[model samples]
Target: MSLFWSIYVGVLVTSNLGLAIFLYIYGTRVKIPIEGDGTTGHSWDNGHLRESVRRLPRWWAMMSLTSIVVAIGYLILFPGFGNYKGLLGWTSEQQVSEARVANAQKLDQMFARYRQYPVNQLAGDSTARQYGNRLFQDNCAACHGTRAEGGHGFPALTVNGDDGDFVVSTALAGRTGVMPPWGAVLGEQGVTDVANYVLSLSGAPHDAARAQAGEPRFKETCAACHGAEGKGTKALGAPDLTDHSWIYGGDLASVEQSIRDGRTGHMPAWKDRLGEDQLRLIAAWLRYNALTEREASIAAPVADARR
Candidate 1:
């Protein structure tokens, strides 16, 4: 802290402590007027309520004194009064760093066996998956949902399950997917027609006449990236529009907005921060979770039939 702030804080703390001490001492010792029959002259409420004084309870006084002592001790041992640094020279930053080191040491022991196995082999281990899940929640849960279900513009991790190779590679090295804005190129009506046609690909509710008008424009303009069939190209990070899963949305309005405004998504690389092994672990966890979800979805109908 600056010199002025340090002095200001010190003064405030000291003044408060001093005032408390003064009050405690003065309150116990000060004498009050006592008329005959051991009552002060003060009276109220038709003389029913009369002011009376008594000595401070020994227990209460002791407790207050003890609290003052504890407060002084705390100030002496810890950094409470601005930048005093305290007698113990302890710091919150130092404590955090020490905790992190201890945690790393514990994790090193756990990950020792994992180091022996390659990422592909590690993907099958339950222990690795658990650790990977923790890492995912810590790092990737903000963009991707806690369950990896994806948010607004973020792509769901479970959509394309391919043993996690592609996801892991993408994680280690960041990738950017850009859908260039076409509002300027395509007029308002043209954008709406294209959106309707895009929605029609997935069998969503759309005007057939509008879709028919939009198909020719889509083939000429969007075919390069989205493909003529509108299934999209995975190699280019272009999403498959034919599927039910939509990143922005599958609705007419949302689709129109996407066409007009376009969208850009970025997945930052974690190689330098998380290392290759950690990335592999996270990828394995994602793959395992996706497979679990897929299996449950398939079993739901069978279970319902059996019931």
Candidate 2:
């Protein structure tokens, strides 16, 4: 602290403590005159009640004195009185540093054991998944939903056929997908037609005539990134239209808007924020959830058939 602030704080502390001590001593010893009724003649409620002066209870006085002593001891031993370093020379920063070091050591031991198993195998371990779930919630849950079901602009982690390696790489390095604007190239009617054609590829409701008209244009333009089959290119982070998985809505208007104005999706790198082992844990949890969901999806139809 600056010398001025340090002295200011010291003076304030001394004054406050001195005032408290004076009050304690005076409260115990100072005499108050009482009328014959044993009241201090201070009336309240139109004299229905009168204030009474009694000695500070022995127990209360002792407790107050003890508290004052404890406060002094605390100030002497800790860094509460101005800029004084205290007798123990303890610091909150030092305490926090020690705690962080201890935590890091524990984490090192835990990750050491986890390193033995592949992420796919680690996904099966309940303890690893628990840790992974916490990591996912803390870091990944904002864009991807709690269940990884994703929102309008964000792609669903659950549906993507990304393995643990892909997930880890993408998370560590991040990825950006750009869909260039085709508005000028395609024109207004062309944009609409191409959108309908794109919808048709996904088996979504679209005008048949428009879809037919736009197919040639789609193949000529969009097929480069979207693939000839509209299945998408994983290397480029292009989304599969055929799977009916739309990062930006699958609706006619939404599709038209995307083709016209274009879209950009960015996944931020977690390399500095999260370590490789932590990322692997998250990837494992995501893989496990995806597999479980896929299995459930396959079994649902079988169960329905039995019914």
Candidate 3:
């Protein structure tokens, strides 16, 4: 608090305490005239009630005095009298700092054990995966779905069958996925044709004539980042156009807009935020889930053949 406010508060508290003390002393010592029947010269309800002066009860007076003493002691030892940090120099911030330090110390021990193994190997560890899944839910579930299946613009952690390394590295370093605006380069019709062609790669519904018209244009312009087959390059963070896993929507209008205005997907670096060990744990969880999905995909055909 400012000096003015501090002094003002101190004066207010001191004045209140003084007033309480004055009231207690005056209440006990003050004498009043009494009638012969041991009642003060006051009556109500046609003399059925009469005011009687009585000494303060010993227990009540003692308790009140004790409370005053306790209040004084509390003010002296703790922060109540403005801007004073108290005898022990305790603060809410200091308490929180101490708690965080203790929590970090415990986490360090757990992380040290995790550091001994690689992320892929750690994915097989049940206890590690459990911790990782919890961390993922807390941090990543907002953008990536609860099951890491991804959302409208957010990329999936495991859904597209991406390797653990890709997810871990992306998290550690961060990435900005930018599909530049092609509206100026390719006119509105060209943008629509290209969107249709891109859709055809994934076998989504598209006008055959429009796809044919844009095929050559796509090969010339987009084939560099997105391969001729539209498989996409991992290094470029270019999404696989052939899959149903569309970062943006798979609809013709959505695809056209993507081509016209373009899209930018950014994944914030977690190296500093999560640290190495925690990132590895999260990567392990993602890998384990992806592996499970892969296994399920493999088993499905076998089970179908048996049937």
TM-score of each: 0.68, 0.88, 0.80
Preferred candidate (TM-score higher): 1 or 3: 3
lDDT winner among the candidates? Answer: 2
Which lDDT tens digits does candidate 2 get at residues 1-307? 8899999999998998899899999999998999999998999999998998788899999998998899899889988778998999999999999999999999999999999888889889989989998999999899988988788889988876238888889999999999999999999999999999999997899999999999999999999999998988878988888865688999999999999999999999999999898999998899899888888877987999999
Lowest summed lDDT window (length 10), candidate 3: 156-165
Worst 10 residues of 1 by lDDT: 156-165
List lDDT for all candidates, in order.
0.86, 0.90, 0.87
lDDT at position 70, candidate 3? 90
RMSD of 2: 3.0
Among all candidates shown, the one with the greatest TM-score: 2
The parts of candidate 1 lying over 4 Å away from their true place are: 44-50, 117-131, 178-264, 272-278, 293-307
- The regions of model 3 sitting more than 4 angstroms off are 23-63, 160-162, 184-189, 292-307
TM match of model 3 to true structure: 0.80
TM-score of 1: 0.68
Instruction: Give the root-mean-square deviation of each candidate in angstroms.
Output: 5.2, 3.0, 3.6
